[model samples]
Target: MKLVVRRSVCFQGHQIPDQEAACQQSYGPDLEYRDLMRVTAIVICAALAGCQAVPGEGPLASAINEDAGRSPAEIGRVNAAVFDIVDVDNHTARLVSDYVSTALKRRFGIGGGPGRAVIGIGDQLKVTIFEAGADGLFSTNDSKQATIDVVVQPDGTAAIPYVGTVRFAGRTLEQARQEILASLKSKAVEPDVIIGMGDTPSRSVTVAGAVNRSAQIPLNLSGEQITDVIAKAGGPTSQPYESYVTLVRGKKTGTALLKSIVENPSENIYVQPGDQIFVTRDPRTFTLLGAVKSNSRIEFGANDLNLLEAVALGRGGNDETVNAKGYFLFRYEDPEVVLGLLGQRRFDELARKGMQPDKDGRYPIVYRFDMSHADSLLVGQTFPVKSRDVIYASRHPAVDLTKFLRVIGAPVGIAVQGAAISNNLSD
Candidate 1:
């Protein structure tokens, strides 16, 4: 006795209609429903497992997954000073001003003059004596004049005829002339003297490194500036923006960009004797990574390199896969500056915990630029990219979703095929 059966299925709450006309060989209706439900449940479970296994798979899987556990706010709270690009640029301008002011003060002091030029031993002097009388000691005829070449002695005196050994070292040219005139007043009748520097051997500034010609430039009464000495050495061989000019005067030393020294009058302080001016090609550079068209180290070509220019240097802005809102620039900034930028309450909380910068006097700082906003273009224009900075553009959400879907497609396909095969066999 053959039992007539109809093929019907119920999945979750939805029922499939029965083929009543077909009285096929029986796979018991209750058993078939149980089997279908079991297959459906297995497929759903497999799909869920596949999703769980591939959670980290995506186009941005490598980049975003690394920090998946930390949200933006949580990451910011962990001792990393975060700011918008616009605020960062404004603060950086203040920082540059402070640096310039400090550099000027260090090199030039309160007054911008080069100060007095003191005579020293080993310096040559051209001394001219004039006599009013025809029969005077220095007179050969009616034009009564005598010239003598003198070198400052180690004991700070210069030997002269009838004037004995006079102390002239450590005195200016005018002072030396007065001393010589007083000494000769007792010897020659109505003697007058004029002292001028012939070749200054002891007072010189050394210009070295990256200049076309490195030399020891003499410091004269003209009070030549740093730029003047550098120019005498044939100027800098490297690009001004890429070069750094360091001034070492006695125990004090200061460094600034060559471009800054050229553009800012205060920075072109007078060069003092014994000052060492070094111009080096210490080019500032930043790293471009993540969703940029090209990832590499980019040197700053200008004195002020804004975010837009930096992005362009890295082979144009971010690619299609980038998240416009997730552009980031990482740097090390002064701790005090970071705190000042954060303002009162947040700074107080962080300071209370004794959060200090490292030995380099820098704290880790991160700046976000939301390219999604139209005003961000202007912000990018003003935002400066400092040396050793890292510019990163994060991947878009769609990239992750597409990657996940691609990763799970095979498993899901297999599950669907299995369900279809089970249905066919049951039918």
Candidate 2:
């Protein structure tokens, strides 16, 4: 039988202040307090083995630097949008109901298929009284005046005069008319009752949590596919959709993948009645603050992001102006802690590949890849990206912030003194 041990160390490569480094070194590597380097060596060895000899994706499970081959990247950049959530408390519902009503009017008779289906307690129904003649059963009143209120009965069915106690609560108008005809055949001699639904019913699906537009998606049975529902409520606003659309059906919640459903036809599932679709945004993003083209938070694609891809999103590096050699990554120091929760096989492979820090402190626990390697097409394909890794491209040594401030400060001071003297003379 083999035994396994776990370890962690917080490594910061930025050379400490002279005062702190001298103080820490004087404490000596003896007392238990000096655990940073002692513990780091074990993780360093794990990380080295990973960089040099690891084969396959299994070993470097949490190594964010691994490449995903050439297939996914070639797809190029598509729409990188995010969704926001909306609640159906009371006031918003009315606005949605009115909008859906207009949409239904335009959609009528355009498609041979059934019109949109909507659900709400107070939807209206168009009931026309037609007297049979040799020609046809013409409407007694204008189609406008014949519209009637759909009332709920004690038994749950809606009430109508000629078609008393017709069951229309849960059923669509089409389904309700079929039930009404079945009831009338038993009483009148071959009665002719024509029914049509007025306006799209005002039913809603609640969109809650981290999306861009989280509002109720007005439903019509005519509408199908999860995308149709998302489109109805405004699509995601950010790049590369993160999180997922969750369908909450009572106590049971099921997940609908955003990419697979959008990219693949087989995965698109239909929205059911009383279903709540929620889109959640991801908090895991690379924070690139200094000396970059677009200094903003870049949220990585959930599955396919590596070191090179992260830089590419920021329009790559402007090495001609800034120093590319100073580029580095910052993340939670202990990669093993996060890997352990992912899978056991993954953890062992990461350890064996030296992706975990070495038992003898040398390089960082994480790999430091050179962006220059991307010049070669083969090497670029070999690199992979992981979620939440922060990439920072440091300023060139020749250009220093401290020096720039000192050079500018003298001129501004001289100008200020001259202005003060001139102002005193004017006064």
Candidate 3:
């Protein structure tokens, strides 16, 4: 009472070899192919059930599952509160006109150099007195030359031979010479004085950090600038494009890109006495992740970098896997900017929850760009990329589907092949 049966199974369009053909030819009526068909159906059903058990668990699925509880409308509501959806054109113009233009107008005033250099405390002076007589009070024998080295004291005066103390601090070289001549006039007949600077410790700017040489450059009557100080310090250790200069004058401080300081005259402000200039290799960088060609930190070579340029640097979004509509930039934006984007009511709500802006008055922001349209290419050209930004391009639905199919198809194909081989071996 032996029964014969035939079964056909396919996994992802790959047909399983016919086990019944060999079984029927070798075992005749003794072999029951119905059992083999039953086993094949059970294995495939188990595989499909396993896949169905974890539906929507592909790469992109899992990646987006974190926010799956929220619907699209709800997600839009949440994003509207914390995110800014701007077209490329509007953001591009806003960045250039608002951020860059404003920064260029901020220039520190530098004093014009007077005819005579002013004297200050801690300055070393070389005084030479010339007498009209053969042997004056400052002269010995027939020599009229009397050279004296005196450092300007804290009291702003310098000691002179028989001339008492002369106040030289805050006085120009010509003014100090006149004061010295007036003092020596009573003691000697027609005494002429020449005062020269031996050391100029007070009139210098300190340059430090990321330079070939850290030094204190003297500020002369020519009026040195920020660039001049950096040059005197042997320039920056890093590339100018990849470096920044910080100028600290007294209590006030300002920072600009080294390349900008070199190219833009306004950013190359005058370097004053006691000003500290630090050249640092702290280039503005953004982190690229997800479906980008390269997922790493990308440094900006210049002062301005738009979204298109940033994406190009990351090798453009992965064409095969990226979701064109889901490109995002994560950043902390100024509260005022966020207010302008999200409106005052939503901002106030977030503020009430103790989500205060940072020291820079900026709140957490996420910027989404839809690259699905051709016009978005123009928008990406003008949208600026700020420092510490995170750029991400989500995966496409097809990529997730392909991944899901692979997960299920592999085991089913293996089971079909194994069942066919076992049936052949048994026969």
**Among all candidates shown, the one with the greatest TM-score:** 1
Provide the TM-score for each candidate, comma-separated: 0.70, 0.41, 0.63
lDDT comparing candidate 2 with the true structure = 0.45
> After best superposition, candidate 1 residue 250: deviation in angstroms?
2.2
Residues 131-205 of candidate 1 have per-residue lDDT tens digits of 989888898775798989999988988898888887877888888888889888888979999887888867888
**Between 2 and 3, whose lDDT is larger?**
3
A best-first ranking of the candidates according to their lDDT comes to 1, 3, 2
Q: lDDT per residue, candidate 3, 122-143, as tens digits?
A: 9898999998887688876668
- What value does the lDDT take at residue 56 in candidate 3? 43
lDDT of 1 at 312: 88
| lDDT values for all models | 0.67, 0.45, 0.67
Give the winner by TM-score: 2 or 3. Answer: 3
Specify the poorest-scoring 10-residue window by lDDT in model 3.
57-66
| Error at 239, model 1, angstroms | 2.2
Taking every candidate in turn, the Cα RMSD to the unseen true structure, in Å, is 11.5, 20.5, 12.2
